[model samples]
Target: MQPTTRLKKPAGSRNEILTVGAGDRVYESTKLGAVFDMLINHGVPADVVLRDVNIPHQEVHSPQTRISLTQLMTICQNALRLSTDRHLAYRIGASVHVSTYGMFGYAILCCPDFRKAMDFAMRYHALAAPLATIEFSEDKADARWTIEPNLHAVAESALYRFVTEMQIGIHISLMRDIMGPTFTPSEIGLAYPQASDFGLPQDQIGCPVRFEQPANQIVFRSQWLDRSADLGNKTTYPTIVALCDDLLGDLKLRIGIAGKIRAVLLRDIANPPSFEAIAKLLDVNDRSLRRQLRQQGFSFRGLRDELRTQIALKYLRHTTLANEDIALALGFSDAANFRRAFHRWTNKAPSDIRGE
Candidate 1:
């Protein structure tokens, strides 16, 4: 794992939905500002989109607030569905100016060179609160970032592609912010097939695009790494990182028992510990823990099952993992038992998901 890499999880409902309220799943992070603005510019109703995602109307309107993956994902779904633009992700993502990213963007702008900017991005990306994991590396010929969006159980999902494309657009836009507007990636590689004429509105971020790649990648020349940034400042860069570090501490602070348990569980989600184990780790008795969850409108079983169902569906939709393998990974007894429980939770056969 790279030093800068991190991933997050989801929650919702009656089956695939988390039993907890949307409030519990949220963290006090920045708003989905630009995405919503772009959606509205396209004539999509912001209220309708928020309603579809089951978020408060005020959440998106506020400059800073709590947001969860369910809220973000559903917002994208509604925005894409309601809008007429086919290349919505590319348009909005590319149009994003680094200044809109707040202090984090400003820090990158202050870096002495592209190399420092890349390193700064690796370490400080959490300040931006990205949903996808951005991995950076370099070979003799090329410097590359292989981006993997979370919730990619089905690589072909519109949600996945939209999120991924948006990331690509941000890279193009932000690199231009640091490296200059004339900078172009050596190439762009996508894990999924091309959707429509992907490069339409060709005046933006024009680069060679390859489809059906093993990973989503943005490749550029290693020579560019040494290129000096236009606004490199020794003073502002460290100050920005220090402020962002403080912000990160605040983000890492766990507020509720549910959130605390979620952090512990996700650490080793593939082989989850028992209720007793979680209880011991939290320095609480089982009865106390149970009471605390009930107060939050959730149960341990519901929380664990919600995470499992979410990941299982991701695997079913995104990967070709055998039923037995996914079951074992989730600590299920067997494929047969896994299938039965999945139906109970989702009211549909597991195969039914893959079929769709």
Candidate 2:
């Protein structure tokens, strides 16, 4: 029998919508930064993100604070073209290829087991780059890997193309950290057409590289996935998880009730519903709504700004909406406010965004 498209899982109680949380999975390193970088690159201004978190723009790089899972998921859903964040999680994987860790490089060195290790990196890849994606599969005797993103045209520009190269480079480098430097892959594939664009293959990945392939993937012996390492790295897993916990907490720190409010705002924003109107929809008092948002890491004002930021970018990049029209659609007072906000988020004026 084939895998069913929909499988029912246990819901906690009647009328309760169950959702998957981050602790349920693992994420790859640097991929989280890569995803955050993609959101900035696409349109969500760093200042706005900082403001949403109640941090100054200059402090965004502070290692002390982290963003919340709710915020990350909210933004990812708004900004990404994919159907689900689970599909986006694959960006955390890098090709281990011929490294000393063998096929178990990521699993043995840093992960408790192959499955947990794979899932760990995948779960947090958003902190790295929003556009990165990795897919894993088993076919016959080989484990297959696929890494690529449906990057928007702006993200496909020369700068981001170079960024993609660096992303791939970091992936291999991290693998080398766990595995010996002598590692090589049986076969390597890339979606990019120009090998030169990625620089000399010998220098970049230190292995044979193939370009102009139908997809990007690496095939290796499946047995490697099950092999246990001589040493256990339980200590490493906690440290990584702790870091992720902190990052998620930073976003949660601000606007504690933002999550619940954001949900209602998303539904009524198109129709310009009043706060009292939205509160009635939730069957709660305004005070109750505000308090709930405080728990969710955002406020009504902040979520409204973020929602507008996401909507503006999608319209500008994916649609042919005029600036004036987009401004109106986003409920901005006018095109000027939209232009200013767009500039703040992207560091680029609307004309440049429109390629005018």
Candidate 3:
């Protein structure tokens, strides 16, 4: 028999995504068009896949349209429900290429090397319109990309798998686009257990896959970062990057004051900027920041607590970091404060939820 340990859920339950930027609706709609079209190709009626998604196929054609992550999650849910292909997320992702990303793709094409491309993508990933939140990191031997759907009130392992696989598929497709068709990640990690129902992702991923891992990550060699891109252009790269930066700025504006604040806070969540300092950095007066947050039915403290709660949970559930270290990561002065804060945010003791 398998051994099991006590695993207490987070505030909304462990299954909920509960990301930092909780209420942003900045995702591009065109991405979902692919999912919609895929369903259609699978003999699923257009209306059937879009039942409660409320997005019209025509609207996605517009370059300016944006949708919420919740909508994307709903579309994936619908797609999974009606389609028999359990690896539908990977299939949808595999179909994506540089051309699918619009200006974001162009910026990547202009990158001089794989390292530059990875940096460029990480810096402007919001433009790529991922179904989940992805963070990039590197160590001595490997470059890694971690995925988190981070959707508010979202649960269901199936939905998580769908979002995670689709994102990985997109990464693989884009890597192949720039690094030649031969490129593939060294390993893939899935947060969920390997169950028979979801189908085998390794078949489509073409890489070693590990399940019940700390995170959903795509890992590749650090040396591959030096590989030259087939389409890299030293001259045009800067110009394209400039345009991409402008596009990113515009997108951030659309993401709103709270969303922007969340992004800034995430940069240094362990020692987040003071609300006043953040206001000044964002070039908005404190009054305006407070008013905007109030209008959105949020307060800075509330947002901070929510972000801290999620980060705290991730640390406890994913890492074996001592409570004091996790406390430091959340900007708590000491472990006792972190303990109290954790109890306040989650209504459960930290030790109760820490993964075995």
Candidate 4:
């Protein structure tokens, strides 16, 4: 048997107190679409799940449509409530094929090796699930993939568990498809506690599972990172990546002026360009840019602050950089000001986030 440990939930579940932002972020509809299709194919009445969640049946069919993360979670919650099986998430995840992801899937399939495929997946992950941010880190012995859901408001709910499980299951299934059936993670770390009658995730995931960890992650041997993908297509890899890029660009445009500005701000995080500079970059005058952003329910300052908060939290959680350096990287005047602003944004200190 693999090693396993469970920790007690922290006082008051700080995660529940943390805000998840405006909850306006969306994911590619294809993910939910694939799951719903599979549910229907399995003789399940998925329509009830959609109806209870207030999601139109037609919306799931369009790959171009983007669904908010909140709605997606609600749908999953409803599915779990209605389905008799405890492992509904695992089943849906296993049924999904890489081709279900459209261009994003193709890009991964065409990579020369697992490492390169992971690079492509990380770069274009938003194309599949914009509401979750993924990070990959590796040392001589192991590689870790950490998934941080942007839906903090639902962090303590069963919806969170279902979605997190489905995500892990999907990745496990995808990896197995690529590396062949024998591959498995070295271990799995989950933020949620184990269910009382939790199905056999260890057996399905092919690894020992740890619960209530600092983060949700999967660990695997580093040696496998260099393994060649069975479906690598060097001849079409470039074309597939280009096509994926186009899809990403189109998605950003669909998000409107606010999304475009957010993209620019992220790219220029070290020294965020001025409003006039960003307007010029977007080929619009300053006044027009402001007006367009306003129309899209965003202000330049608000967007910048949100972006900074996001980057700050990411740095605090994922990197060991000094708070002062993070402040500088975020273009704050100094560490003190960044701390004050961070508190105002999150109602918690930067140190607290890092400590977790």
Preferred candidate (TM-score higher): 3 or 4? 3
lDDT of each: 0.71, 0.49, 0.76, 0.71
The total number of steric clashes, by the backbone 3 Å criterion, in model 3 comes to: 0
Name the best candidate (by TM-score). Answer: 3
Model 1 per-residue lDDT tens digits across residues 31-53: 25566778777776768656566
Model 3 C-alpha lDDT per residue in residues 125-184, reported as the tens digit of each score: 766665666678999999999988645323677777777888888889888888888787
Q: Global CA lDDT of candidate 2, please?
A: 0.49
In model 3, which regions exceed 4 Å deviation?
1-25, 257-356
- Which parts of model 4 have CA positions greater than 4 angstroms off? 1-27, 41-44, 52-55, 197-200, 256-356
CA deviation > 4 Å runs, candidate 2: 1-61, 64-110, 153-160, 195-200, 223-227, 234-356
Per-residue alpha-carbon lDDT of candidate 4 for residues 173-257, written as tens digits (9 for 90 to 100): 7777777788889999988788863343566777898988999898999888777677898899989877876564444333656
Best by lDDT: 3
Question: Which prediction has more favorable lDDT, 1 or 3?
Answer: 3
Judged by lDDT against the true structure, how good is candidate 3?
0.76
Error of 4 at 223 (Å): 1.7
Q: Give the TM-score of candidate 4.
A: 0.63
Full candidate order by TM-score, most accurate first: 3, 1, 4, 2
Q: Please, what are the lDDT tens digits per residue for candidate 2 over residues 94-187?
A: 3323232222333335676654654554444443423446656775677656766433322434433333444455455554454445544456
